[model samples]
Target: MALYRIADINVEYEPRFDMLRERSKKYLIGPSDKVNFKISIKNDDPSKPGDNNSGLSDAECEYIAVGSSFYKGLISFNGLLLHASAVAYENEAYLFSAPCGTGKSTHTSIWQKHFGKDKAVIINDDKPAIRLVNGIPYVYGTPFSGQFDISENISVKLKAITFLHRSDINTIKPMDGSKAIYSFLNQTIKPSEPELKLKAYKTLDTILNSVPVFEMGCNMDEEAAEVAYKAMKEGICNED
Candidate 1:
């Protein structure tokens, strides 16, 4: 078994699976002071690019198994892996989540453009981790970033969560508590256990209470970002 540092936590891989090394290369550490996650995959064959294997069919299943385990472990420790695009702007993390092909990435790109190419950056395009650190939620970029492979081994203070949907014109509105809770449960790495479910929702409730959530309806354009950001900033700074 080899220990790997992933998502700002120590992970020990059982059976010494090396295929995931590429994704975790930057996280390889000299020695782990602790183990936050564990995975055993010697029996599974991971896919490699251009390799004459059964494509990603087998790899995809393995990924799901590993991912599920990691998610459960994370949630057990007040952390959550959200299915969203996390971007850092003005030293705060903003998340955008939506259904497949709903242009989640496109929306954040506009944010990057609005904040200036150098000022704003996508920390993780998918599967970023949100963990409660000393009562404050922080978002971390993980290795499981989606195909575009856009991610960095970094963490940022989370400011808000935004649910994106396609609409004719750009609009942003504060989400209701019930709607915010459900939307978070639907979009995050959900845990099936009864106790875990309760803890997840409680943590979410606290987060939504402090950090404003918004449902952003907009088209695929730069103005969408401007409108959304303006609404969110004003709302957050002015909230009681």
Candidate 2:
């Protein structure tokens, strides 16, 4: 068994694959007598079959399994996984969320280019954790950060969440409360258990009430980043 800290939570789990161990090396810590949770995956877990069907090796399968378990466990601590690209700029985090192939990472890369590398850092390219701490929503990086494995073990105060869509011209607008909730829910994991699902909903409610939500239609251009940053950060909608 190994101990690692993620999103300010100490977790103890035995990684049976080298890839998982390597991917999680940065989060490792000295043996701890106390842990927030522990995860143990048996060889015959149901995930193996689904992963195999998806053409992933045993090693890759284990990585997915571990991530799923961790995110599910995070719900108890007022945290849940958000399928988004999280970037930190000037000590604040901005999350761009969307369905797969929607260019979430591409949009954030534009931000890096527009703001300069020194100002923008991709904390988690995928699957970042959002937790409510003392009534503040924060985004955290985890090891299971998509195919590229681009992530840092850091947490930043969340400023806003923007849902992305493809468009010929860059435009953004504030999302309505009902629309925001639906868009946000589609991007996060929904636990199957009754109690955990309720907790997840409550946590999401706190986040929605505390953070701003926007819908941005953008193309892959530096101007896209500029438009989004201006509207989200300064509340200046150029198109309006």
Candidate 3:
């Protein structure tokens, strides 16, 4: 096993993942700023003793899946098992954390197409990292990209966490912190252990203290990002 760092957090990778090492890389996910994941399992060897194999004992396989999901890059910072689209730009990440067919990926695509080459990076169209450090919320890129390209784990002071909604025009509205916390919590992919719940609450507190959460309703356009950026800037001002 070898350990790698995502932000300030350390993750342990199974030596078995070594076979896919060339295809593997670390990434950050959600607002929690969790560890990188071991993506794309090319081997399902049941007799294997290592973490990357699906052939291990049930308990071992489950444990490896859990650990690797966070450490290998299958999980995101918000704690959700994400299939939604995501990307990062100008040190900030914009995520569409909704269920399938909610236009999350489409929203991300609009940004990429309009934002121009090299101006933006998609941590993962499917998974990104979110974390709060000392009550300052932020997002980071990861390797589990969905529709777009994946970039290195780059942290940005968060502007906002806006849920996606279809609409006639672009608009960003403040979401109740408590409600936002609850919704975001529901998205996480983890065991409902007591300690995990406690940690979740603590993480939510950190996020509330750092960033302004919102409900974004809009057509696929650049205005949404602009509105989000302005709102985040305003929040930053208030904090200052």
Candidate 4:
């Protein structure tokens, strides 16, 4: 097993499965650490990549891609995943999730720009880990980064989770815990097994009880960041 380290967390990719080298190299966000993770990538359709040696069945490859992180215990899918961006600042973590192309990155960038880039960093732009510690929800950074080359092993106690939507101006509204659970589940990519679903529900319940959930609607501008930050401070500071 080859090892890679980032932000002090160790990752290990077992046995050096050479067959997956090309795809793994292309998608690798960081180096392997002590934690064992197996990642596999396959063409969406066999005809697309057009390679004879890519013998993986579509389903198996898909499972490896989505389920590998949890298998290694690097992240807890809880049968849910989110297409979101997260960042940490002032001892707090914020998550902005939405369907693809709905500005998760842009929203994160706005905050980084406002807070000074060095002081703000994205935890995960594609898939971040959500788990509970001592009954408090927290978000962790995973190597499964997306368009943003901003993955490092990092975690923060979750301050809030805000589902993103477009608006003419900035607005932040409190989310009902029950409704928040559904939105949170919808953001997850896949949850094939029943155990994962049960785990996810438990995680969501922990989150609802521990942190504030909100709906964040804003224009595609920096003002959106300001609005969210201020609202989060008001909403979660006391809870913390």
- Which candidate comes out best when scored by lDDT? 2
- List model 4 lDDT by residue over 6-32, tens digit each: 222344453233433322343344543
CA lDDT scores, all candidates in order: 0.75, 0.91, 0.56, 0.64
Worst 10-residue lDDT window, candidate 4: 15-24
Please provide, for model 2 over 1-240, each residue's C-alpha lDDT reduced to its tens digit, 9 standing for 90 to 100.
899999989998889989889989999999888899998978888756564586888888889889999999999999988999999998999999999999999999998999998899999999999999997999999988989888999999999999999999999999889999899889988999999999999999999998888899999978999898888788777554
- lDDT, candidate 2, at 200: 93
- Pick the winner on lDDT between candidates 1 and 2: 2
* Highest TM-score scorer: 2
List the RMSD of every prediction in angstroms.
Answer: 4.2, 1.2, 7.7, 6.2
Cα displacement (angstroms), candidate 1, residue 210, comes to 2.2
TM-score of each: 0.86, 0.96, 0.67, 0.72
Cα lDDT of model 1 by residue, 51-170, tens digit:
454555445445445655666777767788788998998988889988778888888888888889688888889778888887688988876776667888889999888888999888
Tens digits of lDDT, candidate 3, 64-166: 4433456323223343233445567777666667765778777766777777657756656665566665566666554434433454666765665767778
What lDDT does candidate 4 reach at residue 197? Answer: 55
lDDT score of model 2? 0.91
| Deviation from native of the Cα of residue 84 in model 4, angstroms | 1.1
Q: Which ten residues in a row have the lowest lDDT in candidate 3?
A: 71-80
- The runs of at least 3 residues in candidate 1 whose Cα sits more than 4 Å from the true structure, single-residue gaps closed, are 14-19, 42-55, 236-240
